[model samples]
Target: MTVTDQLSKVIDKTSRLIDLCAALQEENDLLKLENDSLKLSLESREIKKTELEEKLRVMTLARSLEGIQPTELGLSEKTLDIKQKITEFVREIDKCIVLLKK
Candidate 1:
């Protein structure tokens, strides 16, 4: 083949390679964004799961305490708000526990 023909072929191949590289870079950036979004979504789900588990634990403790007399619970006769009772129960079971306010 003539040198001119070989040079033309190389130029065409180079242009295609550049275009391909640009397309691949754009796709890679999109994939990275999607991956980051998924990571955030997973983190949100985990936080929700933890919150639900805590609520469940508090509810379970409340149920067990229901059948027991107040004296058994060691709570004073002072008016016990339902919310306060749940908070107390959670604190009794787990020190340093933070209960989400309903």
Candidate 2:
């Protein structure tokens, strides 16, 4: 082949190589942006997970309080006993009121 033709072929190959390089660089930049977005998404999900765990902890603690027997609870026995007696009295009074209604 003529040297001019060979040089022309080389120039064509170089141009193709340059286009391929630019395409690869653009794809790399897009992949970097996607990677960054994924990282932010993971961070946001982690934060939400932590917040849910905290809420679950609080709910568990409230449930634990529900299991506490009034007698064994922090208040004095006298105070709790008085409150219980008052509740019983109210129930009896309610029953009497219902009977009167009937």
In lDDT terms, which candidate is top?
A: 2
For candidate 1, write residues 7-101 as lDDT tens digits: 99999999999999999999999999999999999999999999879866866575577877556777554434466577778877675444433
**What digit string (tens of lDDT, one per residue) describes model 2 on residues 1-102?**
999999999999999999999999999999999999999999999999998797666545644666875446666656654755686699999999999999
Error of 2 at 52 (Å): 0.3
Position 96, candidate 1: lDDT: 42
Clashes of each: 0, 0
TM-score of each: 0.67, 0.64
lDDT of each: 0.79, 0.81
Per-residue error for 41 in candidate 2, Å, reads: 0.7
After aligning candidate 2 to the native by TM-score, how far in Å is the CA of 68 from where it should be?
7.2
Worst 10 residues of 1 by lDDT: 93-102
